[model samples]
Target chain A: MSESAIITPPLSDDDIMKLKIGDRVLITGKILTGRDSAHKRLFDLIKEGKSLPVDVKGQIIYYVGPAPAKPGYVIGSAGPTTSYRMDPYAPLLMEHGLKGMIGKGVRSQPVRDAMKQFKAVYLAATGGAGALIAKNIKSARIVAYEDLGPEAIRELEVENFPVIVANDAYGGDLYQEGIKQYRR
Target chain B: MRRDISHEKIKDTVARLCIDANYFLGNDMIQAFKSYIENEESDTGRDILKQLLRNAEIAEKEQVPLCQDCGFAVVFLEIGTGVCFEGNIIEAINDGVRKGYTEGYLRKSILSDPVKGKNTNDNTPAIIHTTFVPGDKIKITVAPKGGGSENMSEVKMMKPADGIEGVKDFVVDRVLRSSSNPCPPTVVGVGIGGTFEYVAFLAKKALLRNIGERNTDPFYADIERELLQRINNLGIGPMGLGGRTTSLDVFIETHPRHIASFPVAVNINCHVARHKTAII
Candidate 1:
C-alpha cells in the first residue's frame, strides 16, 4: 500500500528482504526471459548436470514469450505468461542463486517455500496488458534457443517496468493474502 | 436459390477480422472496465483495470496485438444451405489465417503436433466449427482463445440426480480452485447438456456473446445472473491480485440432452475477450 520500490537485479539478499507481498515495484536494468519451452530445456540441463547457457546467479527470470519486435519498436507485446508452468524448475534455479521471478498467477507451495529458503521473490506485471507493458522494455535480444522462436531465452533491458510482489522471502503471498481480504 | 460468395472475398474478410479483433477490444468490455473501475474497492484491482484500458488504446493506435499470446484462432462458420463457394472453403480459411498472423505481426503460438510439437509458425489450420443454416448468407465469428484461460476449462459428466445445485457448485468451485491462474476478471461460459465434445463447443461459443447479453430463455438467463454474482464475489479480482471484479459476466447455453445424462462444461476466457464476427 506504500509507494513503489525500485529494483535493478542481480538483486542482493537485502533487496529481496525489503520486498513484501502486494508492494508495487518499478524494475530497471537487465532480466532474463524464458517460458514453457525454455524452462523444460533448462530443467533438462540441470538434471543432466550440465551448465546452463546463462548463469542463474543473482538473476531474475521473466516468464514470457513475447511477440517479435515490429519495425520501429524495441519489443512487441511483452507481458508475463502464467508462472505455474515453471514451478518444476523454479526451486532448482533458486538454489543456484536465481534471486527473482517475474510473472503472473500463483506459484506452487514448493516454489513459495523456495523463495523463503533461497532469499528470492516473485513479482507479477498486470496480465493481458501486453502493449502497455511492451513500452517499458528498452531492448530485447535472444540469448539461446533461437529455433524456439518466441519461447527462446532472451535478455531484456527494461526501465520502470511495473510489477507487484506476489511472493516474498518472508513467506508472504499476495495472491493468497489479497484475496483473503476481499473474498466474501 | 443459390448465392455465390468468392473465396478471395472470404479470405480477405477473415484476415482483416483476425488483425482487427486483436487490436480493438470489444466496446462492451471497455464499458465494463470503466464501470468496474468505479466500483472496484481494491486499489491494485482498479489500477490493473486502468492499465488494461490504456493497453487497449495503445494496441488500437499502434495497430499491435493487445496481448502477446495472439491466441489460437477458433473460427465458427455458419454456412447457409443456399450459399455456394467455388474453391475449398477450409483452404481459404487457413490461407486467411496464415496471411493475417504473418502479415499482422501476430505471434505464432500454434504447435503443429500437440505432443511432438513444432511451431506451425504461421498460426494456421484454425480450429474451425462449421454448421449449415437456412439462409443464403455465411456468418463467421473468430474467437481468439489464449492458453492461460483455455487450460482452465473443464467438462463434467454429472449424474442426473446431482441436478442444478451440483452444476452450480462444480462451476463455482472450478473458478475458485483456478483463482489467479486464468487471469481473473474472467468471462465464464457454461454449456449444459449435449455430448462431451459438443458441450465444450457450446461453452466456448457462449463466450463469444457480448458482455451482459443474457440468454433468451428466462430460466437460463437467471442461471447466468446467479453465476456472475457468485464468481465476482469470489474476489479473484484483476489478474487475481484480488477485488470485486473477478468475472465480467457468465453466459449459459443449453441444449436437450439424453434422458440418462447431464453434462456441463466451463470455458474460462481471460479479460482480453477477443472475438470478431462478420456476415457475408
Candidate 2:
C-alpha cells in the first residue's frame, strides 16, 4: 500500500475519516504514550471525574512502554504493546475527544463501536519492531505517572513514525479483512 | 562425584545471555523470517517479514532491545549430578537478571505483584526451571518471553476419545483466536499427554526448540508438521496483517499420561522468538 502522512496532536475528524484500513501512514508530530498501567490510572481518574494529567482532547495515544534509555539517547526501543489490553479504556478516552490510537492486535467490539461513533481511528505499528520504531522518536519525556517506570506516560516527538490504519471510523477493520482475504 | 561450578560464572553468563538474547534474534528465528519472506504471496506479508529482518539488524547494530518488552527473563537450567554449585544458584540467576536488565538497557517490565501493579525496577525474580542430568556440564538457556504471546497460551484437558484430530483442532483454534494479539507468524508449541500443569510446562519448553528442529518421534513429528500447515493456513500472516505465513513452525512435545486424562497445552512464541544458551 502507498503512504499518506498525518501530523498528530490536532488530528481532525476529517483526517481520521479519510484514512481507510490498510492505508500506510507516516505520523509526524508529538504523541503521548500509554500502556496498561497508564490506561488504568487514567480510567480511574475519569471514573472519579478528576482531570487527567494530560488532556485527551483531539490527541493521539500510542500504546507503548519504552525501554529505559542509555546514556545520551532520547529513548530506547519504543514500540507498541498489545492493544487488546487497552480496549476497555479506549472508548472512554475516545469519548473525551481522543482522535487516534496506535498499537498492535485486534480490539473488542465496544472499542470498534466507540471508534465508529466517536470518529476515531486505530492505527497499528508493527509488533516487535521496537528498534526500528524508536529511530523515529526524536525525543521522549515522561508527562505523568512517573512511578510506572516503563509504563510511565511519555510524550514523544516523532518524525515519520510509520503505521497502518487497522480500524477506521467508517467500519473498516484491517485484521479481519486481511485474514479473510488470505485464510484458506 | 562432584565438580564445582562457580556462582560468578553462572551470574556473568546469565547476564550476558539476557543481553544477547534481547539484542540478537536467534539464527533460527532469522532463518524462519527469511524463508517466510521468500514464499509469502501477499506483498504486505513479504514486506512485514522484510521489516522484521531489518528490525533485528537495527537492534543488533544499535545495541538496543529488539522489542521494548524485554520480557520476563526465563531461565532453564540442566544441572548434571556430577557437578555442584558454589553458591545459591537461584539467587545468582536473579542477580544476573537484575544486572542484565539494568545494564543492558532492556525494559523493566516485571511487576512486583500481579494484582498490585508495582514495577520491579530491575526486572528481577527470574523464572528458573532446573533439571538434573547425569553428565558434568551445566547448560543454561535464557528465553526472554514477552507477555503478549505468553498470555495467548492455553491448557486444556481433553477426553481420551478426542484423539489427535481433536488436538489439532484445539491448537489451530487457539492460534485463530489469538489473531494479532500474540503478534502473529507465531511459533506454536503444543504439549500433549502429560498431566495438566506438567503439560503446560512441556508446551513452554517446546518453544525452546530451534525452529528447524522437529519432534523426533515420527507420530508426534508428523502431527507437528500438520499443525504448522493448519496454523499458517489460518491466514493470520505476519503480525496478523494477513498472509500465507501465520506460523513459522509447530513444535510438539509429549509425555506418558494417565489412561483417563489427555492434557494439551499451546504456548505461542511471537516472531521475535528470542532465546540464547551457553554450556559450562
Tens digit per residue, CA lDDT, model 1, B1-280: 8999998988988888899888899999999999999999999999999999999999999999999999999899999999999899998898889888888889989999999979999998899999999989999988888999999999999998999999999999999988888887889999999988989989999999999999999988998899888988888889999899999999998889999999999999999999999999
Question: Per-residue lDDT tens digits of candidate 1, residues A1-184?
Answer: 4668688988889988988888899999999999988988988999999999998788999999898778999888988999999999999999989999999899999999999999999999988899999999999988999999999999999999999999999999888887898899
Candidate 2 residues A79-170, lDDT tens each?
79999989999999999999999999999999999999999999999899999999999999899999888888989999999898999998
CA RMSD per model (angstroms) = 1.0, 1.2
DockQ of 1: 0.86
Candidate 1 error regions (>4 Å):
none
* B1-280: candidate 2 lDDT, tens digit per residue: 7789998988899999999999999888898899888889888888888889999999999899999999999999999999988889998899899889989999988878988767778898899989999999999999999999999999999999999899999999999999999987889888999898999989989999998798999988888888888888888888888999899899998999999999999999988898899999
